[model samples]
Target: MDPLAALRRPDDPACDVYLTGTVFLDIIFTGLDAAPVRGTESWARGMGSSPGGVANMAAALARLGLRTSLAAAFGDDMYGDYCRDSLERGEGIDLSMSHTVPGWHSPVTVSMAYEGERTMVSHGHVAPPRDPALEGDRECPPRARACVASLVPGEPQEWVATAAGRGSLVFAGVGWDDSGRWDLAALPELGHCEAFLPNAAEAMRYTRTECPLRAARALAERVPLAVVTLGADGAYVADGRTGETARVPAIAVEALDTTGAGDVFTAGFLTGTLAGWPLEDRLAFAGLTAALSVQEFGGSLSAPGWPEVGAWYEGVRQYTLSPEAAAAAGQDPEALRRYAFLDALLPRCGRPGPLRRAVPTIGFRRA
Candidate 1:
């Protein structure tokens, strides 16, 4: 089936995806040879700033040509305006479900990249006021085909339930708990969700499993679909309804920074899943998307468009046909098998034109 066919509905339903969560002004310092030592000043070879968190996923989905809408609170400040404008103008995301707080300060995060990984420090209010409807102030969330959000502690997260009640697929993810508690008690909150996605460590810690596959199965028992991302190992997914499971290996690339790779993976998965792709195809596409993202520096700004994805598919296709090239590519059999599905899909998928350039804006001062 043609992936784009699912999105040709003419009826207005607000958006293809409704993403609500934190949005951070991410100041990324890359090209660092080592992790910053405490109380020491270090120089970065490259620097960039862009929206993070839900914005990362939103921009990715929007770039993939999804009619994405973001619903979250923004501070009454320049940072907030910058984010709002960048997402709308730069990525074509809809902000109708979003709002601005009268005096809140926009959140910010400082990320230092080194050795293909990143360490970040963020400052923001927890549970920043969401759309009033999300807080039970109105009837329902803005209608969409899917709703993406994080799991909230100590609350039922009525928005997920409301969105599901209104016939939207709810894709739920969780954040890391610094307390090292690795609580699985909150897993029940996802009962109303259609899918639960978490990175490998979080999934293992929560499920008390030593492997991602076991953790994915444990999580699959709760939600209709479960996905556990294994960083360099790629991703494992299970469908509870069909009792099927699959693993897609990661694409090989010289990774620069792993900052929002997982979120980008989710966006890619969302694109294929929403478009009715097969399970293995969804995982392969998401894995390829993330592998391409880490080759760049910025967080959401580094997401690949369909054109990039198609180009990569074409490159891989040619590489596999030539014995010497395939040997040099060094892709595992599983990864090659997963990506092989793209060989046929790209021809039918329309190319995405050049991305809109992000408007330069000064970020909030970091201490």
Candidate 2:
């Protein structure tokens, strides 16, 4: 069932979220004990491939039951075909605004996961420019309730402002500034954004604040909402409009791979915001989704759906109900209460069956 079904309107935007960016074919290797030596060949215990980059967030949103539309460039190669099929057929993402270029190879990233951390090596060529005519009758993006923008340090995308002007709430996140110029002024698009989500390191560097919470406060001055993700500690959010602030601790889980966890966090936050969840609930939900993502391998495929969320909620509820189980796990019962809001949100029929997951390889024939 669609989580936002109650919020649906006859005149609502065509999609719940719209995203545009490069989609990379991610080949991931897991279960490594250590980094490979320069001259040594290390065999990984597990491997998987899936669409990554912006596809990570798109997949996450779709899995969370959001109607997602993606605008991206794909190559004519097999990697591109697999990615297109996975997103469109498997994940149910709208790709009408996407395009394929002749002879343009798809971007590829090789990720090695070990000890909850990952090392990535990438190769790709610049994608072809998007054709405005392909978007629709206008030279604008498809109307959406919200859009996620990847803010590059020096380059500001005009579509962000256009989307906002067209009644779409723009949520922006930034990549690392390799130029060493952590000037916030470089991200002019923040003026047109409803929210800005950055990791702790990026937030501190951009705001020149020593603390992530202080950095989020400083950023709230520029954007309506500022969110700073503190990897292990959790996430902090400040609302400039209401001066409401909240911080949620991260869920403790055995992390298999941390790839695309930040993107998953952003998607989770977007879901809660669109659903009109409370501040603390939103942070907790986002943190929970991110926590679930890290327990699996790969990026796009690792994102959790409603069933996974439901399962986790049930497990936690059961744990809290049994004093023995609580003590055995060494988990605080009070910490589990933070997610009691899920009781009202989850389907009463019970958890759904397992959904499709990321596989070790692409291009396998389905029987």
Clashes found in each candidate (C-alpha, N, C closer than 3 A): 0, 0
- Considering only N, C-alpha and C atoms within 3 Å, which residue pairs clash in candidate 1? none
List candidate 2 segments past 4 Å from native. Answer: 133-139, 348-353
Q: Highest lDDT, which number?
A: 2
Q: For model 2, state the Cα shift of residue 325 in Å.
A: 1.9
1-367 in candidate 1: lDDT tens per residue?
A: 2355646767847578888777888888888999988899999887777888789899888878788888777878888888887798778888877788887899999888888778999998854555445455443477788888787544467678788888788887888866677776755568788888999988898889998899999988888889999877879999999989998777779977777888888888888888888998888888988988887666688888877888887777656567667776685543465577776667766643565422234544569
For candidate 1, give the lDDT: 0.79
Worst 10 residues of 2 by lDDT: 347-356
- Against the true structure, what is each candidate's TM-score? 0.89, 0.96
lDDT of 2 at 149: 98
lDDT of model 2, residue 175: 90
